[model samples]
Target: MIEAVRVSGLTKTYPARRGSAHVVAAKDVSFSLAEGESLGLVGESGSGKTTVARMLVGLAHPDSGTIVINGRTRERKDHGRSARLRRAKEVQMVFQDPYGSLDRRLSVETALRDVLRWHMPDPAKGTVRARIAELMDYVGLSEKHLGSRPHQLSGGQRQRVAIAKALAVDPAVLVLDEAVSALDVSVQAQILTLLNRIRAETGVSLVFVTHDLAVVGEVTGEILVMYKGEAVEHGATAEVLRRPRHPYTDMLLSSAPGPDWHPERVSELRAAFAGTR
Candidate 1:
């Protein structure tokens, strides 16, 4: 399979702050994303999943690693206005809070128009409108909804708009950092279904970062489980979920809600696991 994104020996460490020791956000994490493939990066809070997503989209710099997006190696010199815009074109990130990512003052149409105008060469009124219409269609929104602002839309609608904005640039990779975690279960399912359809239609690679194993199982083919900033297990999503190798992976799987879920069992396992780590 052709690689659309690759990260090798990825590591990042935040400096020590007042009365706090330095934190190693990620360490020697390496993974490759096949063209049009979805990879799930799963772990609990502080497992470095979000850090990886940030690094992939150039939001956070890696201390030591190479990130090749769309076959272009990201370098330290990839700074400044032009390179930043170029990077944005290669990869776009959909944040957890849909409202936070969008402009409250701008209508959905205006928000999408700004992105298309900034990214597209033509930027013509007619062309921009056509593209905005196309984007709304892609995200399952109607023309009437385009005139609504972020506050006017529901949680799911706002998320759809966010997804549309990310796709406006026609990015090679889309990093979803807890993108659907903020929605209700029904809304979550809708967003996941929408994501699956979008992936099928666009052929864009996806790096789905979330702590929920169940969520990843629905949308991702491959899974990478992280523990304490290290990848403890990586393989086909079904296989890993069926027969998790690492202890941390097993703990995570057992904690997920299921027919036989036991909250007390989860607590015991978590406590036991914490002692080992």
Candidate 2:
């Protein structure tokens, strides 16, 4: 399988308030995604999972390291129009909050059409409308939805629109930064199923970043366990979930709600978490 994204020695740092003080957001982080493969980045809050996602989609620049997308290395400064455009075409991001991500003022048609104009300008003007309708249908939306504003839609509908917008560019990699985290449990399940169906049909690599291990295990085959700006453990989803090597990872799994919650596990996990802190 061809690698869709390769990050080697990826690092990011922020200046602290004190002199010569700095906060490391990500350090020596490395991972890769194969075409059509889903990799879940699991970590607690401030674990740099979202930072990695931002870097992958070019929203945030790494302090040091290389981001090779589809075999081309992306430069931090001025990445040039050609490089920026290429990055935009190949990588797309789905934000955590669907309601917040959409522009309430714009109709679904306008939202999608604007992205099409920016990313896929070569399509004929007449065909663009047809393509918009087709995309809406692909994401389980109807013509009536095209005229509706984001406020008129439910959370699930809004998320579907976000997915449609990401698909508009036909990107090779979809970086989902807590994409379904805001939805209710039932809605989250539906969205996860939708994502799986889309991936199976379109063959797009999915980078699912989330704090919920159970959610990640449901959708992703591979897992990258991140803690304190670094990947503590990397392996298959089932293996890592079943037999977590890192203490932080074990704590996360044990703390995650399950059908039969164990008080002993919760106590153990809490103790582990306190120790880490």
Per-model CA lDDT versus the true structure:
0.91, 0.89
Candidate 2 on 22-83: residue-level lDDT in tens?
77999999989888889999998999999989999888999899998888888777467777
- TM-score of predicted structure 2: 0.94
Q: What is the lDDT of candidate 2?
A: 0.89
Model 1: CA > 4 A from native = none
lDDT of 1: 0.91
Q: After aligning candidate 1 to the native by TM-score, how far in Å is the CA of 220 from where it should be?
A: 0.3
Query: Which ten residues in a row are the worst by lDDT in model 1?
Result: 116-125
